[model samples]
Structure formats: structure tokens, C-alpha cells
Target: MSLIGKEIGEFKVQSFVNNEFKEVTKEGVLGKWAVFFFYPADFTFVCPTELEDLADKYEDFKKIGCEIYSVSCDTHFVHKAWHDVSKTIKKIQYPMLADPTGTLARDFDVMIEENGLAERGSFIINPEGKIVAYEVIAGNVGRNADELFRRVQASQFVAEHGDEVCPAKWKPGAETLKPSLNLVGLL
Candidate 1:
């Protein structure tokens, strides 16, 4: 089943941030927007690039009241090790979540049971803790933070203006379509 519009469940896990281990929890994120970014594992190919890309745009997300969380089955130690070794990862200011037991992977339905790894998944959760949007991609393909940022803006716009719908390639200032009987057969 699709996770869109579904409320997030309670969870707490260790995370690496600012050269220290911290605990991140669903409860703590309540009333705040969050981006849960799930990847296969740490110290692997492609993951760092994706993370660094997100890191570069993290301030934009933060400006929009969204906290980015990069999750993997790797432990907090592994996350720290990767951050220490990878110059790209070292630039990250977001939390590096550790999902060693695959609880998060299972919850997000991104677990690769056979390999004990997770597929690439990205979820945008609103302030109410409900998932507003999500995307799951193949392991080989990476995601774009700019696109995701735009999606977050769209979601927020729609939430504030329930009568309007964002059109293709919608940006913050773009015009929105209002559903009406008069427009039924127009577009």
C-alpha cells in the first residue's frame, strides 16, 4: 500500500550528527516537517554522492522547516566512520540515522530481505507526522534534492490552499488550477 497520507509510527534511533551520536525520534519531529532519506548502506558507491547532494541543499530544506535524515542499516559507528573518511560526507550537517535492525527499512517497506539492505527511498512528512509524499527508486538510480524540494513546496501549497492544485512543473509563485465544473472539459 502507498504510504502517502499515512501517519508515521513511533520510532527512536541513534544518529550521527556534529561529530557526536544523538537520538532522533518520531515524537521529536512531531509538529515539524521531516525528510526521511533511506539508502541501501553506508560506505557504498552512489550513496555518498546522493547524501552530499542533499547536504548541499539541506539549508534550503531547513529554511522550509524540513529536517533531513539520511538512514541506512549501518550502525551509528559506521555512519561516523563514513563521515570521517569521506570528504563529501563530512560536509553534511543533517543527521545520519542508523537503522541497524532494519526497523525503519521495514516500516518504510524498503528492506531487501535477502541482502539485509534497503532500497533507495525518500519520504516527505508533514508537521502532523503524516507522510505527504514519497518516492522509491531502484538501487542504481539516485534521487534529486531540487526536485524533492519543489515537491515539498507543492505539498505545502496544496495543504494551505485546499481548493487549488499545482500544475506540472509548479513553483512557489506559479499559478494553481482550481477544480470547477466550468473547467471540467477545458483541460
Candidate 2:
């Protein structure tokens, strides 16, 4: 089943952010753009590199009214511990959501049932709490924050301009395709 256009279910989880622990809920994520970035685990190879890359672009995401939430099945304490020991994790200013119970992982359909771990998933949610775009990649593969940012930009543009569709490699101020009414019968 596709999660696109699907509204997220209710969830409340603890997060480690800015040297403190706070609660984040589905309600809190509403009324704004959000990115839920799921990884296999913390303190593992490739995860930090991807996370650090996101950290580098955190401000850009924020500037565009988007919030980044990095999620793992690890506990908040584990998140804080890793942040303390690793300089790469320390660079992260966004929330590190703890999905110890797998509520979030299961909700997003990224859960690995046998291992109690999540795959590498990136979800872009709109202000209405519905998923607008998402991608799930192999555990060994890392994703690009720049591409994710571009996707968010595209999604936002398409939402606002319902008649136009973004083209390949679409960026702000780039041309968008407006489907012609006469083309419907050609297909």
C-alpha cells in the first residue's frame, strides 16, 4: 500500500534535541512541513555520515518552514549518549526521535519486524499531516539531503500550484508543466 496522501496516525515519542529531552507528537508535527528520516540504528557506519549531511543543511530546511526529525529504534538516552561521544552527531541540531516501541517505525511502514529495526526511509509530510512524498532505500545505502530538500521544494510548489507539475530536476523559479486539456484524449 502506498503511503502517499495518507494521513499519519497518532503518535507521541521522546526526542533528544539541543542537549535536552522533549516529547514530540503527531499534533506537534501538524500545521507545518516535516521530514521524518528513519535510519537502521545509531552509532553505526553510514548513519552518521547521512545524519551529518542533514545537520549541515538543517538551517536550510528550517528556513523553508520544514523541520527535520531523525528517528531510530534506539532510546532517547542512547541518542544523547551517541551525541555526547560523536562529533558528527553533536553537529545535529534537529530532533532525534526515539522509537523504542517501534510505534513510529510501524506507522511509517519502515519497520523490520524480526530485527526490531527500521530501514532507511525519508518521508516528507505536509501541514495537514498527510505524507506527500517518501522514499525507502536499502539499509546499506545512504541518501542525499540536497535531493530531499529539492523534493520538499517540489512538493510544496505542486501543492500551491495544483495545475502545474514540476519537471525533472525542478527548482524554485524553474518551469513547470501544465497539462493541456486537449491531451487527455490522446492517451
Give the TM-scores of the predictions, in the order they appear. 0.95, 0.97
lDDT of 2 at 127: 99
- Cα displacement (angstroms), candidate 2, residue 135, comes to 0.4
After TM-score superposition, what is the CA distance of residue 89 in candidate 2 from its true location, in Å?
0.3
Model 2 stretches astray by more than 4 angstroms: 182-187
Q: What is the C-alpha lDDT of each candidate?
A: 0.92, 0.96
Model 1 TM: 0.95
Q: Which ten residues in a row have the lowest lDDT in candidate 2?
A: 178-187
Whose TM-score is greatest here?
Answer: 2
Q: Count the backbone clashes (under 3 Å) in each candidate.
A: 0, 0
Candidate 2 per-residue lDDT over residues 1-187, each given as its tens digit: 8999999999999999999999999999999999999999999999999999999999999999999999999999999999999989999999999999999999999999999999999999999999999999999999999999999999999999988889889999999988898973553
lDDT of 1 by residue, 50-73 (tens): 999999999999998889999999
